[model samples]
Target: MFACQVEVVVLTCEPLTMGEERYYAAEIVLKSDFVNGRVGLQVSLEDLDEWERCLDALEAEAGAEWPTGGRSAWLAVVPEDPVEVTVHDSPSTQIAVRMPIDVASDWLEENRLRLDRVQKAVATVS
Candidate 1:
């Protein structure tokens, strides 16, 4: 029997006058051979346009090449079927990405390209 699983880990950094507060949120889903592993991550933001802008800024800062622009970053994993995206009213903005456990290493490596930019951005605020 084939076994597969998917999980999502979100790391959010909020900057303050003195320092930054980082929040980590995670969700795990498992599937057996009979079922295909599926996972979705919801990113909440006060404004949809702002959320897109934030993601665009992140991509531009990272200078990482994406075939479909920054879509890969948030989708993380290209599902066989369309994944639903929900926008809601919230005080803070968030960006969520989902991926399969087996390819977690690959995802990490792909994302690591933005480490320098992320660090730089955080440093500027702190």
Candidate 2:
């Protein structure tokens, strides 16, 4: 059992250019009773779909790690009785936060819908 409550919010998805390369950025904000942080995740349409697949195939002993496209920050999901969401930010110092939330019947569907919305938003950003 965990004592913290975690909430992840996707603020927006926008196109970003670094030098000559382009990528879609997802502004992810994570909040919990123990910690709060934000990250700009560089992802493609395929990445979003991959995440959906990860969520779909998640199991109690088999967890999933999100592709953060960074070495310092990372996110993972652990499927227990109460799903555990953990985010680690270690640009200079390590700050790892974990929280557990009850998995309602619609939780997975809700997450898939959120990912679909993000994919659409990314596709429309020109």
Give the candidate number with the greatest lDDT: 2
lDDT of each: 0.32, 0.64
What shift in Å separates residue 14 of candidate 1 from its native position after superposition? 1.4
Model 1: lowest-lDDT 10 consecutive positions:
81-90
Candidate 1 lDDT at 19 equals 28
In model 1, where do residues sit more than 4 Å from their true spots? 1-5, 18-100
lDDT of 2: 0.64
Give the TM-scores of the predictions, in the order they appear: 0.27, 0.72
Q: After superposition, how far is residue 125 of candidate 1 from its true place, in Å?
A: 2.2
Please write out the lDDT profile of model 1 over residues 45-74, one tens digit for every residue.
222234344445443443211122232223
Choose the strongest candidate by TM-score.
Answer: 2
Error of 1 at 110 (Å): 2.2
Off by over 4 Å in 2: 1-12, 59-61, 68-72, 90-92
